[model samples]
Structure formats: structure tokens, C-alpha cells
Target: MSESDLQDNNPLDPGDNSNLASGEGHSEDAPPFVPGLDGDPGSDQEEANNLEESTPVESDAFNAHVFEGQFEPNITSYQIIWQGSPNYWAGRGGNKIVAICDHIMQGSMESANSWFKNAASEVSAHFGVARDGRIYQWVRVENGAWTNGIMNRPDTSLPWLAEAIQKKINPNLLTIGIEHEGLTGQVFPEAQYQATLWLHRNLIQNYGIQPDRQHIIGHYQIDAVNRPGCPGTGFPWQRLLTDLGATQPKTTTLTSSSSSGGFLTGPVPGVVSGAFGPGTVNTNNAYVRSYPSFGAGVMVLRKLPAGTLLKFIAYTDQGAVYKGNSRWYLIDFTDKGGWIHSLMIS
Candidate 1:
């Protein structure tokens, strides 16, 4: 399906969401959760900070797209500044991103900048969207951040904990945490809301995640006794799904064989395919575009030849279809090495 097709699907429509207890994570759409334990987050705050040993961060001066990193932002449009934090696990241990958990800072962005940076704070969300709309990525999405699981090991087998207990993994391993500024009594900022909408859309799209409460959840869902009002009151839970259903991007797949006519030139001396791995290119040359889709106006990053050696870091299947393949691998050559279509490699 094309980008338009994704937008046309009402997958996230609030009307279609029914709160059915499926046990399996995101097997079906669920309705908005009504807050049950809304009170002072005082004790939970202490418990959360007391248990896990930490993780946010600072931004650089340069606004360059060509970054010095191993992974690139899935949502490329926003002004996302990489604020490296030290309090996170190295990787997800092969676990895919299953949920995007929303959280409330309950404090100012400046406080988050200081606390998330402090190792003693022992808490860090993957991404933080400020009230002013500045997006900060404290931890890479591929890693297990000390966001929700930093709290005391949840020993309770409450019905709400069905997903994590059943999966037999730390909640952090299965979810991406997003901390939004403000709390229950305050009105959620529209600017922050818009920024989060795009962030959620891009994040869920990358994993083909269902845009529902089961996947796009609040922190309260993880540990209700502690953070029952997380991402707090006034947050537009239903509207988030409705808006995403209408505006999410759709990657259309076109079936054809060897339609990469533009890549017919001879192989270059040291260029090759490494999006998925060191798979030698079978074609003459493959174009590394800035993003996934191939189009007239898309920016081509490199023209790699068949003989060039290659290696890869990660991949995403959300890319546009080419020769019946929608898979693209992320090469670690540089932040701008971009993506190579899977078919280009042998």
C-alpha cells in the first residue's frame, strides 16, 4: 500500500477500539483507560528512584544531518537532538519494540535535563518532548532504557501486568518510553502533543506496531499502583489514536522484477550493499537514498557497485516496495550512509 493507503485505514480510530482483554500484547485495539489510582505520586517517585541504578543529556551546536553515530532517527523531519545518557542497557537483546509507553515528567524540562543526566537519578526515557516542542532523544530506540523498569521489580501479578509477565521479559525490553512534560492537573501542551503525534507515528510505523492502547500505552498501565495517573489527566488519549489513523504514513509496495533502471551503471571501486549485512551486491550498482522510497526527488546518498564489501547494523521493513521486497537494511558507514534496499544485496 502507498502512504495514502495507510492514512485511509482507520486502524487507530477510537470508534473501532474496544477494550477486550486479549492477554497477548496488541492483538486487538483497546479503548482509553480511565485513571484508577490518581493521587500524590510521592511514594512511587521514591520507589522508582530508589531501585534501579541509572541514565539524559546535552545537544551539540551543529545542526548537521550527517551525524557521527551508528543509528539514525526514524522520524527525520523533527529537530531531534541526540542527548546521550549513560544509564541504559546496550541493546534490546533481540527483542523488538512492542510498545511506546507515555510518561509525565511532572516537572519542568530543565529538571528532566538535570535528573536524566544524573546517574543518581536512575531514570531515563528513550525520548522526551518538551512543552515547547523540542524533541530530545536521550537513549537510542534500539536499547533498553531505564525508563519504566527502573522501579522496584514488579512482583505483583495483577491482571494489568498480563503482557509483561506472560512475555517473561522486563517491561523496558518490550517498550519504548516517552516522557512528556506536565501532570494531571495541567493542560497538556498542544505543541508537545503535535510533536509526540509525529514521533509516535514514525516509531510505530517502523515496527508495524498496532496503533492502539495495547501498544501505545501510558506508564500507568505498567505499574498502576505507582503511576496510575501517568502522562496524566488532560492528555488526549483517544484523539491521539484518531489523529494517527488519519495521518499515518503508508508505504505502498509495487511488484516488478529488476525495475531499478536508474541503477544500471557499472559498479564503483569500493561501493556495495550492506543494509542487511555484508551481502555482496548482485546488481551493477545500487543507490543509497536518504530515506527508503525511490522517487525522482529523493536524495541519493551513494552509488555502490556490486564488488564493494559491505556490513550492516539494523533494518526496517517499512520501506517502499522494490522488486517485491520492502525490506531495507541500515548500514553503519556513517549517519548519512542511509538505507540500502534488501534486493540490491545477494
Candidate 2:
């Protein structure tokens, strides 16, 4: 469908985004979970120190397109407009983009489109994906959009992120922001997911961005304090990472004993409880969502690393099944009940 047609069908009126700033489109109030990290607060300091000691790589080779005056659209198949008032001039010769970040409108596509076009909101993303998977670009890939507020700061704490920020490579300049139409923790439509996957593939290939967790992170990872549950927990991160051929890290074994603050670590030797059986997560970075379904609004509670044992307290026949199983198991994670696809559990 065309961009105008998609906007016309949006549920919210144009420029009416009252819920975006409220808790409507935000993720649940949960502690920040960084993939490949053990959820240790001190890890950030350690990483920062390591980055300080390492040699900084010159990004001159990555800026050839801007220097040569050759600009290519990241997604040529979508509709785009030069709504220039809301964005900033990306310094570093406009060739600093190296990552892709996702966000939820927490409202309607029409509202988001209008907001970016209004110039009053002072926020814009490079692309906006409608529920039907229609894509609209507000800013060119070469310039920085004001979608992410964290980009305004330079002293990022994460070691893997320190170098990028130190070189002024914030999300506004180094990442292509794509806002999806939906609330936080809601299921994202299949079409929208497909469109995002296509866009990501092109961006990764075109920008030479390493298809890994560190490079392609959610908004929460950038500024966990202010944007904790952005793009929410239900965003099938493992599936996307696997599809991108991103390198996987070795699984960390969870320790047994609920008293130790670990959920079920590994499978219980002899545990059986009808459909609510016990199983171990076989894949690293397996997602436990608030709902069984896959979509934009689906909330992810936590991403359990490999070998975390969990009990299948309940099951749902509905939802996407990656493996041969169509059932999703509900489990208690972090004192809250959440769902996970049965295929990821052993």
C-alpha cells in the first residue's frame, strides 16, 4: 500500500500522539538486561576501562561514501520524504552510521508520521513501519534523526559502546532508527517484521555493520536508565540475530537452587507435571516473553541464556513455533509469569 493510504487507515488521528510519552508504548518496569553480559552492574565499568586501554580504530575507511559524494538509500523499495526540520546535521561528514535501532510508536502510524512531519515534536526516525509492513522514510540515511535522546550524551558506560560515542558516533549519527507502529510488549505484525528484516539486511550489507548483538542493539541498551523497555522484551532478538548470521557466544550454565536467585538452572533430574513439564533452554539468549504470540506488542520479560532450566507451567496452542512444536509454555521468570516458544527449550 502507499504511504498516504496507510496513514489514512491508521487508528489514531494525525498528530495525536498522547500515548507516546506515557507508559503506553513503553516496556514493563524491569531491570535492564544486556545480552552477553551476566547482568552485573560492575560489568559496565570494566568494559569502559577495557575500551579506554584499547587502541581506537579510525573510521575514515567507513566514511568513503560521504567523502566521495555518493549517497545510497538504505531501503530503496520504501516511500521516503525529506522532512528536514526535526533532524540534526550528522557530523563526521555524514558517513558515521554503523548500527540500526528499533522503536515502537506507542501510538498509530499516522500519528507518528504526523509528529515527525510537524516539526513541533522535535523527534524523527529514518524510517517508520506500518502494521501492514509499509515503510516510510522521513530522513535520509546520511543525516541524523532526533529519534533517540541518548545520542545527545557522549560518555556512554558500556565498553563496547565507548569507542563509538567517544568518536561522536551516537545513534543519531551512527544508527538508522526505525519506528514500528504498536505498543510496547505487543505482537508485531508478521509483515512489519519481514520489512524490518529486509531493511536490516540491506543496512548491514551496505554499511559493513557486523551483524552482532553489540552493533545492532535495542534502544534500551544504549540508555537503559531512561529508555529501559524500548522495543520491549518480546522483540524476538535471538531469532533476528540468528537470521542475520550473527556470531553466537558460548552458553553460560545457570546455577541450580531458586534460593541462589537463579531460576531453574538446568533440567531437574526427574520432574514431570503433565503439560506443565520441565525443560532446559537449549539456545543461548532465549527470550521469555509476556505473551506466547510473536508481534510488535509482545513484551519480553527476560532473555535467558542457554542452560537455564524452566518449568512449563502452562501451554498455548496459538503463536509462532520455530520448531515442529506449535505450543508455547508459560513459565515463572523473575517472579513474574512469561511465555517462551517450546522449540527453544530442550
> Which window of 10 residues has the lowest lDDT sum in candidate 1?
14-23
**lDDT, candidate 2, 1-346, per-residue tens:** 1212111222211122246743332222212222332322224543243223212122243234122332234433433322323333333244556677877777787777666654345566777777787766665566556666643112132344667655544445567778888776777778878767766766777767788766777675564334534676556676788978898644322233342233332332212123344567655666676555555565565777667877654444334533212345657443355666654554
Runs off by more than 4 Å, candidate 2: 1-18, 21-85, 90-95, 151-160, 165-169, 256-346
TM-score for each candidate, following the candidate numbering? 0.48, 0.52
Worst 10 residues of 2 by lDDT: 5-14
Cα displacement (Å) at residue 302, model 2: 22
Q: Give candidate 1 misplaced runs (Cα > 4 Å).
A: 1-76, 150-163, 246-346
lDDT of 2 at 140: 50
259 in model 2: Cα distance from truth in Å? 13
- For model 2, what is the alpha-carbon lDDT of residue 33? 25
